[model samples]
Target: MATTLDAPGRGTRRARAPHPAPAVQAPTKKYRLAAAGFLSPALVLIAAFVVLPMVLTLWISLHRWSMFTPITDMEFVGLDNYRAVVASSTHMAAVRNTVVYVGLSAAVTIPLALLLALLLYFPQLRGRGVVRVLLFATYVVPTVAIVIIWSNVYAPGYGPLDNLLALVGVDSPGWLSNPDAALYSLVIFNVWQMLGYYVVLLVAGLTQIPEEVYEAARIDGAGPVRQTVSITVPLLRGALVFVLLMAVINSIQVFDPVYLLTQGGPVDATNVLSFDIQRTAFQNGLAGEASAMAFSLLVLLAAVAGILGAVRRRA
Candidate 1:
């Protein structure tokens, strides 16, 4: 600053501090190259496996093709395949089943998982580790193996479950063979297979809540149920959101059990979107239509994720 008189007679001035020179930056070209090298493999894999297929699917959705024929043989059909998806009764049923399955799975899995997590979080609970291991084993085992085990578990007549039901004077519904019960049976299998994973996630969330908070609640006469409703639920919202998203995605993309057990069913009952897409593409030789269905699924997932994000932000 220029020297200034405090008053015309005093002629006092404020002193300015000297500025420091800017620091020299080291060359970042090599650092950036090393970083790129580290990320290259993941980037390449995602591009090749995820991006390429998605682009190919989108392109194919705009054309007509059969897997048996050469790609050169594909004929441009614009949005006819998409129109077919909208018009087809089987496609509509698959969509409905997918929505219902996701809804039912979330309803059954979230609260049950929360309850299991609460039980498991008790520090003095005996055999909790063993119980956790057994529960998670269902998830860690190959999905194919789980489906095989469940198939027998749901077997009619001579099966253990059926026999037990018989002893109790309860009838077996031929779980996979009854159209009305087939989809529900698959839902039950999914809940059993995925329950442990969600419980483990919720348990992790529970641990982050300091014990002092719970102690304070108890001192204030908060019961277990009250603590869970006010403290636990509010604090664990982040984990619950994650679990909800995973459950919805898993439920919507479910295919293995339906494929292995019901093969899209005693009727069209267990015909979910994923199975329907696979059947349409390879089994029925309607690649174009299948691509359209896949694209539709992609759209649905994106929309749902966006909505969830909005809700999360609002909350």
Candidate 2:
């Protein structure tokens, strides 16, 4: 009997020794729940504001609807609004003006911004901080205030610019009133307004570049022009792409300055896509048509952005 008990005790100890403790797993469910909780507010806001409105606009664009009419009066018009907007002479004019404005603004703004950035980035420049602040001050000023100031400065009868031109024995054309010059004037204004912001961005990008690269270039007897074209420009590719994309988008949607300065006047010379949409929706009460026009603008911008992004990735 004692021998039998000893055998049973030994068997029990062997069984316990061979069995190890089970491994513990992290609480993935709890972690996921916490992440979801953190993201709830932003997700809710985006759904409510962006997603909902976009869906509503798409739906509205399919119907003949007006702000003044009752909801019950809404009638499904299919693609009639889209056809009308595309065929309208006024709409065509707006499209042409918008293309010109964007092209002009990009041509003038990008080069000026790059030049200013280069000047400011030079180590020999004194009082760089003050210069940066002065340039950036335009960005901080209210848009309406800038419009008012520029309007006064460009006024034909009593403006400083015209007076100076008169002193130089040159006739001053009506900058904002003339059909030929109004769009160009808007382009110049946009370039001046946007130059500071782009300069700051370029400067930041320039600063992030390793100083050793420049030193190496210098030791190799590379002149400033060669250094800029070869090393600086290549490294600044990312920043240049970003600035160019923003410039394109801004130029396409230009409204405030044109509206404030020209009111899309002088035979629709300064009318742009944004102004066209506003006039169609509000002034003409053509909600469906306006939505169609806006959608077209959105598609154009998206296509441009996609092309730019592809180029940037390749670079």
Candidate 3:
């Protein structure tokens, strides 16, 4: 046998050092304590402002609590306030008006916003930035200031709108006073005020749609109208859902315009749920009833949200 010259211990396998197990250090008590400290303030705020208020409102809704009376004197009226609200014709009328306002406002505002977004989104449009700023300016403006400015425009005969209508040999109705026209006039004002916000939202939605999709559509011989109808609207469902829900809620809670301009006006043309709640609470001195109304409004909003959520999920 030929014995090969080999280094010492070459025939034996070298002993390998075992790999160290990953260090299993537990979080220190101090680390947990620090996290607790960071979370405490936000938890406290939610408990105080949100949770506490909701609990108290529920409690008050169960009783006939008066602002003028002592807490000890409060009587448990159960659902009498809600029953009364349901039974009242005025409340029913207010609900109807609110429904109409919300419906008409959404119908008008959404389409106008969609159109404006489409127009402004075009690459060939000039001064697009300036126009967008001008449109959005109304949304940032104070509600009171907007009301004041529009009050003049809605003024009878001598106002800008009235003058313009007169130039065309048309007479202007009293937008703030006439029962036939007041609610619709307010709807118009609301649409104008909110148009820019929804337009901005839709424009944002438009930007998210990839340019290649439109290019592909064009190659398929789809014109602008076809592209918008077939592609744009369907892709914009998410933004549209948000806009629709917000529009309905805002319209339902309309108070300032009715209060400031009409005060629920001639034959209560503009008496919405929010205005009704305000009048019940402060003006009519029905605190419990107002609380019930507030809760009812909350329920209405919840129902709307649920329906819309279901639609979105189905889509």
Per-residue alpha-carbon lDDT of candidate 1 for residues 4-115, written as tens digits (9 for 90 to 100): 5486776787767688898999869999999999999999999999999999999999999998899999999999999999999999999999988999999999999999
User: Residue 238 in model 1: shift from native, Å?
Assistant: 0.7
* Steric collisions counted per model: 0, 0, 0
Per-residue accuracy of model 2 over 80-170 as CA lDDT, tens digit each: 9999988899999999999999888888888788888889997677799899988888877888999999999889978998999999988
Q: How high is each candidate's TM-score? A: 0.88, 0.89, 0.87
lDDT of 3 by residue, 73-99 (tens): 778999998898899888888899999
Which candidate tops lDDT? 1
- Please identify model 1 stretches exceeding 4 Å from their true place: 1-38, 310-315
- In candidate 3 the C-alpha lDDT for residue 160 amounts to 96
Whole-model lDDT, model 1? 0.91
